[model samples]
Target chain A: MTAAADAPPTAALPKVRVDYLPMLLVPLLMLVALPLVGSVSTWVTLTVAALAMGMMIFLMASGLTLVFGLMDVLNFGHGVFISFGAYVSLIALGPLAGWVESDNLLLNIGVLLACILVAMLVTGGLGYAFERIVIRPVYGQHLKQILITMGGMIVAEQMIHVIWGASPIPLRLPEGLRGAIVIGDAAMEKYRVIAVVLGLTVFGIMHLVLNRTKIGLLIRAGVENAEMVEALGYRIRRLFVGVFVAGSALAGLGGVLWAFYRQTLTAGMGMEVNVLIFIVIIIGGLGSVGGCFIGALLVALVANYTGFLAPKLALGSSILLMVVILLWRPQGLYPVAKR
Target chain B: MLPNNPIHSLLSGDYPRSRVLGALLFVVLICLAFAPFLFPGSQPLNVAAKICVFIILVASYDLLLGYTGIVSFAHTMFYGIGGYGVAIAMYNFSPSWTALGVGVIVALVLAILLALLIGLFSLRVRAIFFAMITLAVASAFAILASQLNEITGGEDGRSYRIPEMLRPAFRLFDEPVMGVMINGRILTYYLIFFSALLLFLLALRVVNSPFGRVLQAIRENDFRAEALGYRVVVYRSIANCLSAGMATLAGVLMALWLRYTGPDTTLSFAIMIDILLMVVIGGMGTLYGAVLGAAIFILAQNYLQVLMGQFSGMLESAGIPLLPGLFHADRWLLWLGILFVLSVYFFPVGIVGKLRQMRK
Candidate 1:
């Protein structure tokens, strides 16, 4: 006992346990609170909308958090991917909207898949170029990275404004999800339900991929110590590119959902909402996948609740929560690493 | 060493004391006092006055960044806070001597308290995390201000009627040019300029003083400073607080000059970037760079637009429609970003340092 007393305390290190019980329970709690929010059917509609918004937030925050946690690079222009996806989908749906207008289901499905494919490819290419050209140069300097990325954000925004013009184009939803589903006095959009269901499915798949795959192991290891991972001769540069592309792809998917949900794709929306997304990431704990979901839901709730409580004070609540979380847990609720 | 040591020379030890500064300032002031009349009704004077105000802001920013080696993304927040303080005071109460005075005092107090809070947290973090926190807080503050419609005036931004100036027992500027009294753009410009000049002198004194030397020492080697009796964090916080106080003064002046305060004026990204450009271009970490930078920036803004207008025909002939950039319809910041990047990459010492180096 005396000899063992010389050992250093292991308490300094945080033991990570990745069972996602609390995250699962969060949604369940929301579902339970639904009746209290409104009538059962009205609750259903809001719940669906809330869940859908939550998923989009989750996807955006996940990629952002992952990159920031591992690379210590804040990708300020990340919202561009989502906008790109929306634009790509919007263009694809341009002609198909007419078909949908005529009640054609077959054309709509084709348009949806084609749009996602184009968006994924375009955004991936963009992510690849951006990673190599802009992001790679200012690797070690955070200030340079921020200034440069901010410049990129401005450039991206302007480029979008130039192409799309300064108008909010209605995102043509499929005729199938056009109107609200009436459940007694309460009505909710079907697209909102779709967004939640689709987002969750993606989340499940992402969870499996991260937990089970070989690339997942490398990524997890890389997140732990990027330099050491590189030293192990594992094509870490390629990994960085791949991760970036994947992250951008997730943002693109989010953009498609955003188009349908918001029913509009505007240039300024990317930057405006990106700030809140950043807050979500910060509060969620940078780089943690589950944390992003939790953070997104929390932010969504704050946004929703604030509007209900006092419409004038909507933005107030988000900041209030962020400040509280920051002061309480400076590293966030579940910080990725000390660095 | 020959007749003089290089270390002494390197410090740029040529000091222009009280008499020299007094004469220079007197001549400059006299020239400036008359220049408004010379300009007659030139809009450029208005622009120049605003430019001076921003110059003060950038210089204060340099105190934190270039001098102390601290990178604060939220420096503009202090400026905004000061602006808001003045706006609230004058807008709610009638604008008067008492109102502006009370506004400035309150702003200073708030700046000190905020600086203390931010500085305390700032000591616990470094680099990107620090940058993130500042940026987040700044954004949050702006958003919160926007959301608090009742007090802050929300999205449309609250406007206070120009406060009546109480006659200070006797009239000071009875028949000032471009006005019946000391108010409006030209007068506000002078007010900002003189305040900035005094503030610059104050900042210069801080840099040259023992406290300034200690700060530089800490910047160069924080561990060594810590190893000594100095509590590094406390001094850093003090410097930060001082900078914030100065910025608050600037903000109060802004509210006065603009005659209104809103989110646009208070929480403007363009303003933030402009201040940064001023610091970087003028020769950051130098006593005189802020003035040089601001002068250059304003000149560029005015002259660049003129150049573009003059070259419109040439651009048309060259089959290139003038893309005057995105800052305004007249000017743009893409050019500024390019200039900032190049300056950082190359002549990072800025105009003043470059000139000194050239002299060397």
Candidate 2:
């Protein structure tokens, strides 16, 4: 019995070491190696483009992952906040009379920063109002949440259409960042490059907030055990509102980026981008911010690949990716462990 | 509206009360059968048919959702498939008796096939998982339809030339005899209207059966029902298939009536939501609720815009275009949102559910 108890720990060991990230990184490396393949797999270009798009989606879904994972609200109306932010930022500088036109590089940077700050604030406020008035009554009930929120989504879009006609409003980017910059075979838009950078920066900030701050600690604590948090005397409902607002504001930030990147805004943009956004969040994992980030980028990369490589299968590719992910890992590639 | 909730009264062993309700329902059916003569306006008749078809849809959906407590968002996908089935049969085929039978049977079977594929992928996950899977599958089907421009006619959809229905007209005797003429707007309305009536009755019978009682039992508590040896997964799958087939029936009939088909008719979120709204508004978990809900929804929508326009003169003179402010011009989303808030808060059980409860 003693000899049996002393059985080697190495007995259960498998033949191969499973280094998962590099396994993932290999497909990614091969993806980059494609352009070198004489453009034979032109579809690879779309993958890169999709990866770029995915970055923006990741930011939106990052906040949502936390909110939905913690709170049961469907938040289908989250797309509106992004659109609203973009429009608000556009209005702040270009359309509204009180705003001064700033063509100088420093002033332009100031305006962009101001836009981000104000957009986040305004969208957060809107989220608070929505949660208080519309979402509060139907917290636990799933059906009511779905229907009521869906209606809110409809109202948000309609309001946009009413305010700005159905036509796409072209946004003016203060002179300097209009065209593409050639960077060794792949021509990249300065605006899109900025978007990718901003996305990473926000992700970093979120990690700091989640890991370092006291409120973040509470959020982590609440997400793990709600009853325990309430027992600890922290306001959980207030936390939910904060999360919803913050998540919604993140969507707004994405919208602002989308507006600048696209240099145009349309009322229908929210609805148009909705399916893709939700798909990213789902594939990324329901509750994990990091998962949403990767999922969004992954979807964008896949979409871009299909568009560049096989235009015929362009739209279907993301859906196919979603199907494969569900089959392979139903919970998503990077599900979050409890806080 | 009834005096109180029918469920409460029903629980108190008010057995005789249901018989009276049945007799009243019988009378309503007789009147509906003769409604064509009273409502002679072509517009009303056409609207009636459209309403009836939608009612059938709402009723079928309620069986899966309201009764089973599973919200199925891909009901319209089945409806779209049904449209394709009928259109394919009509276009590449004859108007022979065998052709119509083949078309109907194939549509029902194919609907079940699509439902099975969807159920296999989605049934494991409830709530958001189920909702998303259904939405994704439906959108995929819609996208596939649009992408296959040649087969699906793409965005424009397919137009079937329903050659002749000599055999069909003969069976009805008083039916619109000609093919193009019979299916022409006026006659199409009656055809759809009658078919809707038939499907609604079939739906009613199913809802009243012991199977429906089982469904309700599961809805109230799946754990308890499963504990009693009921296979929930199979039951849910069966309900989904039945709903899908019924939704297809409506879609096929509409394809026949409109003589045209488009993904917009069946693939849009609007269609799915509209069916849901109708079921809720008419009443959930009740057969008659669907019929009433559809009638109100389609009619109100058809007339409401016109009613809004009527106020144009007064508003225009007062320096407002009316639509810009109220309808929010291009965005009706605000209205939808507001109404949703109002409905959830004010009419939790929906119009039909409220009225039925009152009757009790």
Candidate 3:
């Protein structure tokens, strides 16, 4: 275990050296799907699109898995943060129509950043209140947590309707972020490329924080045993609150990206994407971040591939993936064995 | 005190004297059955019928969530299956009574099998994992139902003809009674009302039985229950099957009442959440609490919006403009959401449970 902990970020982790066979499923799936797709360019396009979608989902799901893994809270209301972030972004973008219409790349990017920041801040604040009010009392009770959080979600979605009305709001991409770039015979949407970059940056930062920083160490320790962490003189409760806030902020960021990805937002988009998010987290093995990342990618790839191959099966494909994965590894792809 | 044997207690009329709450529910059921005759309106009878269906549905959920300590979100999926079963059978086959009976039987069997499959498969993991899996499966089923447009009617949903006898034109008498027409609607209303009552009682009997006692033991502590020579998984699986079958029956009732079945109405996650709220607000383990919870929830859900509309009108008349929009009938869900959360926190034991506690 000590050796496993001390192992460098890359290569074989001693713990998974024996069971890393399941890790091959992602690549194997991609390889097998390539022939079925039958066009190199289309395959590239599908792969990029899937990766982009997966990254956006990971952004939303990472927080949920963290909160679930660390805090043991099944927040069915996480969708509200996503919806809230998307709606909050609209507040900035709605007025800054001129900036969005602008062709200048740097200025448009600047406007997008500002929207993302606002979304994160607002959602982060909301998460704090949600935790204090709806979540804190039912800390250890999973059923009540599920129920109350779901109730919180329903209210939040309705609140969105109240504020924004029932109409679907348009959130067009900035001029600089619109259209696609040709790479060989394949065309990749410019926004998707940007999303990939942003998603990777988020993942990199999370990986660094969870694995490298002192706070990350404390959090990791706390997830394993909060009492022990407190016994060792760390403020575990404060740490958890911070983690939750961070997760909510991540969901907000994801929401902003997702809104632009679809170029149209509705009140129910958050709830709609929630199933996909759960499938990702479940496939990723609940609490394991790296597993969640892989799980998200796998889900997106399967969904995209199946959508292109058989549209009717697309809706059930991710679920099928989850079931198969669970059959293979009942605990998930990378079960975090905390308890 | 009543006899521990639920059947004996029920037959002896000792149940009402001993269990005041049970007696109260019995009266409510009677009133609900004769509601159409008393009220003489379609709207009131419709609401009463809805309450009855929800009562059975919520009670079935209690069998799993409260008794077996399993929180399965697939309850609504079974409910949808039952509705779609009947709707499709009537759509393709005859709209005759035999077809309806066949549809109900097929739905019940399918629901039980699916429940067993989901329960056994997911129970291989932990409790929380099972919950998540059910959520995934239920949502998948909803999506599939919508996408399978030909048979399920897609978003428009399928509406089927009922047996001739059950149609509204089929009158019972040559003349009206108490200014209320003796027609098929009233007969259908009574049909649902009585079935709901009987199902509620059956649920009560099941929960009070030794099997239910074991389920309660599992809920209180699964590990301890297993330690006391119980196969926890097997018991949970049986409970899951039983609950799913009963929920399917409720779904059959829902389909019959609406004469329609759609993904939105039957299989939606929102309906699942509403069921959870109903169970929680009524009380978890108590069978009678299902009646209280479902009744209160359905009444509030149906009538609260009307009350809110009136209140909004009053506010508008008084020149309280902004508040009126917030209190509009459309925004009733927002208020319901708030109330649900508050209820969960403040009345964790639920209304019936709280009443029971107070009495003690």
> Best by lDDT, which number?
3
Candidate 3 or 2, higher lDDT: 3
lDDT per residue (tens digit) for residues A241-311 in model 3? 99999999999999999998988889889988988898899988888788889999999999999999999
Q: What digit string (tens of lDDT, one per residue) describes model 3 on residues B1-360?
A: 446676675533214222567666767777797797777677888888889999999999999887787788898999999999999989989999999999999999988998889988887567777888898899899888988888899988998888877789998998988878878878888788878878877777788778888999988888999999999999999999999999999999888888999988999987998898888878877766788888888888888989999999999999975787789888887887887898888987777777766666
Model 1 chain B: lowest-lDDT 10 consecutive positions: B322-331
Best by TM-score: 3
lDDT for model 1 comes to 0.71
TM agreement with the true structure for every prediction = 0.84, 0.86, 0.94
Score residue B330 of candidate 1 by CA lDDT: 39
Q: Quality of candidate 2's docking, in CAPRI categories?
A: acceptable
The weakest ten consecutive residues by lDDT in model 3 chain B span: B9-18
Error of 1 at A152 (Å): 2.6
Score candidate 1 by DockQ.
Answer: 0.29
lDDT, residue A183, model 1: 72
Candidate 2 Cα outliers beyond 4 Å, as residue runs: A1-48, A95-114, A172-174, A262-264, A336-339, B1-36, B92-103, B166-187, B320-324, B327-337
TM-score of 3: 0.94
Can you write out model 2's per-residue Cα lDDT over B234-350, one digit (the tens) per residue? 777888888899999998887776677888876777788788777766666776667667766777677765655555445666777535356432233345446556866787666
Clashes of 1: 3
Residue runs of model 1 more than 4 Å from their true location after superposition: A1-16, A19-42, A82-102, A109-113, A166-174, A184-186, A310-313, B1-38, B121-123, B161-185, B213-232, B309-331
Error of 3 at B125 (Å): 2.7
How does model 3 score on DockQ? 0.72
- Per residue, candidate 2 scores C-alpha lDDT tens digits across A20-78 of 65237426844674674456434443344455577777866666678877775667677
